[model samples]
Target: MSATLHRLDARHGRAPSLDPMVQLVAGDMNMVNAAILDRMQSQIPLIPELAGHLIAGGGKRMRPMLTLASARLLGYTGNRHYRLAAAVEFIHTATLLHDDVVDGSDLRRGKRTANLIWGNPASVLVGDFLFSRSFELMVEDGSLKVLKILSNASAVIAEGEVNQLTAARRVETSEERYLDIIGAKTAALFAAACRIAAVVAERPEAEEAALDAYGRNLGIAFQLVDDAIDYVSDAGTMGKDAGDDFREGKATLPVILAYARGGPEERVFWKAAMEGHRASDDDFAHAVGLIRSTRAIDDTLARARHYAQRAIDALGGFAAGQAKEAMIEAVEFAVARAY
Candidate 1:
């Protein structure tokens, strides 16, 4: 293992000193829970092709890991973490399936999207199956509170997706609305992951609240980086193209901020090329130029840093444990990653 991973494992017993994110990677629970996850796959003759394709092309199971690691760091030893982890992963996968369909994306994780290969109908249905299966797994965990958290998060995710669809091409997207969508879609799961850990650990209300905030801030920081990456990154490395947001006429933070800073001519150009779908190759270059001219990339990075710091701050109330350190490392890792 890498030194970072090893350090996390070595400090696992010393709770409140090591970072939980690192422990999740370095310790044995990661392997054990992952093996438990693998067993969920079984023969279903009719659904074999679609199921195989989706599972085989998996992305990082960051959401599930968040759930499992949060519980472990909180001193949870029950196997419920396994089911919760699997449920979170299943929810993430279902969202990906629907997202590919909504974005009409052909590629993800450097491979063909399930929708692209199986067609939208099959992809949507399989996504539904996963959603149902996730709930089934949660139910098997037998905690009504856990069921409620995931259920609420799932609804919020759907709401965020709808908000994105309706808000597309609208030039007047406020920062408030933007945050609303992101919190619901991205942060909700993060909050759920941590909250469930508190529940499993039988932590006090204050501790649960702190863990929830940690997840919330971490999630916001994560999506901010993701949105910024859309503007600045190469599709090959990003597993999706640059300006995917522009092509979809969706106003991300950079686009939103750039609009706030644009001259009349720049505004008109964005309206026609981006919101209006009348864009040509030249328009793409122009939009990039405009975003760069305004330093929106830097602006977005500053905002990302703010959220990352908030995420770190949330851990302070904890007893300076290894889990808290891991939480901090995960935030730093998110920020240092290329956006």
Candidate 2:
């Protein structure tokens, strides 16, 4: 983990932190991870193989951890938090599987995506299987409110996918439109993950809402940071290629912000890179230069920082403890993470 920070500093030039949140989260994250790992092993022949494909890819498991840690921070004392944590994670992984298929993506965290490795048909079916599994687990929780939250989030995620597909490769996509898409696709689940923690804790509605706001803003920050890394970070550090958004013709925050501030030459470059599918190597390089010259990266970082701050602020309403402190550090750490 220290190596990660060194790379971030040597490259994008981030500050050295006293405690990196990923590492802190890592210390105890695997306790909850075991629940998912164990559930993922249930066999039905090929179904096991399909599940292994995603599990072996070894994601950060951020969603589940958020649920677990939020519950702990809020002083919950029960085993239900673990199950709900797994439920949210299943939903998240299922979405990723479907997303890779829909976007025709071949890579994620530098590994072959499920659609790329298992064929799209298998990926799609496996994703459906996982979604069903998540729904079943949510039902086991036996709380209609929790069921409703997950169901609503799932629907929003589906809508977000369709919205992005409809807007794909279009230079006309505005900043507001992009935000709405990401808010639905990414932030909705995040908000539910934390809000459900409060529900399981049997906490008041006010506490639930505060955690929901934290998750929502933090999720937005996570997406913006992801978009920033898509342009700025290296494959080794980011676990994905730079210009991923570019290759997909996705009008990310930097691109949208840059376009809004570009001159005639920059505008022409933006149009060609986004709309004209056939882009030269020179076009990608020029787009990077244009983005760098405009301070779009700085602006995007500012927005991410704002959301991170909002997350920490929301935490203030909760009780003071290690979990709370870790949550604050985690929010800040994610904003400054190498990946």
Candidate 3:
């Protein structure tokens, strides 16, 4: 990674923001949004009504934006990306709807989760509807390669979810296993989203592979930061309550590291907490102190920086331009959110 691609600069006394990437893809996103709205409509009022509750809710739409930006980087002028980007978003939204239900979560993006409002069955079924709609969009695009990449990603995501479910509350879960989980559950779609842009633009295989690397590493960095935020941030700042992961006994990187580094007494406490034996606010505060004492959060952020740098370096072949700059900054913003 080059020094120039660092997440923070001394010249700018603030953290990086997603504004650049958001601005760069704004116009194209409007088209994608239109497609999403059109496809979300159904004869059964409940389908649209339930889907709209979460779809119209606050989300950065980062997955679709990556597709548009990747297309821009490749200088593709065709409109096929619009529907494809919409498909990418449908895949992501469907995952989110299903995830909230699986996690039994109450809040998302500072709002009540759809599962909480509409019930688990409704949320799960609507998620299925969105998944079907995404496949429809893919078929409409008429690219076997694109369909294969995304459909494979969808399958990998489902497998990752099941893998995480099995690992849940297991304090002994290894970091390597955790990475495999996130790589499939989170980074697979990210990789597919950017790779498909290359397919649509008729770019060479190398460029497709490069974009996949960029999105894959960025997705890992993004998830790392999100996991760190669970310990450092509040509901207002992070859109989900602080310590939710701790209460849920999620074996995120920080917890894994802290458990590895802790003394026997600390390890016992961690085991109890993960087993749902310690869940009070005081217990959570103690867990945070233990994680801090072990330097878990700092090291977690350091790991995030490592992957973010890799993501930046993955774009080395692309020419320096607005699209590349925005893509790089987006990677910066992914890790910077923890600060």
Who wins the lDDT comparison?
3
> Tens digits of per-residue lDDT for model 2 on 89-116?
8899889989999889998888888787
Model 2 spans with C-alpha error above 4 angstroms? 1-31, 41-43, 233-235, 276-278
RMSD after CA superposition, every candidate: 5.5, 5.2, 2.0
TM-scores for all predictions: 0.88, 0.90, 0.96
The number of clashing residue pairs in each candidate reads 11, 0, 0
Output the TM-score of candidate 1. 0.88
Question: Candidate 2 vs. truth: CA RMSD?
Answer: 5.2
Question: Clashing residue pairs in candidate 3, if any?
Answer: none
Model 1: runs farther than 4 Å from truth? Answer: 1-23, 26-43, 46-48, 233-235, 276-279
Over the stretch 1-339, how does candidate 3's per-residue lDDT look in tens digits? 223443333223556778888999899999999999999999989889988888899888989999999999999999999999999999999999999998999999889998999899999999999999999999999999999999999999999999999999999999999999999999999999999999999999999999999999999999998999888845367687888899998999999999999999999999999888999999999998998999999999999988888888889888888898889888888887877
lDDT of 1 by residue, 56-97 (tens): 665556676676667766777766777777777778778888
Task: Give lDDT for model 1.
Answer: 0.75
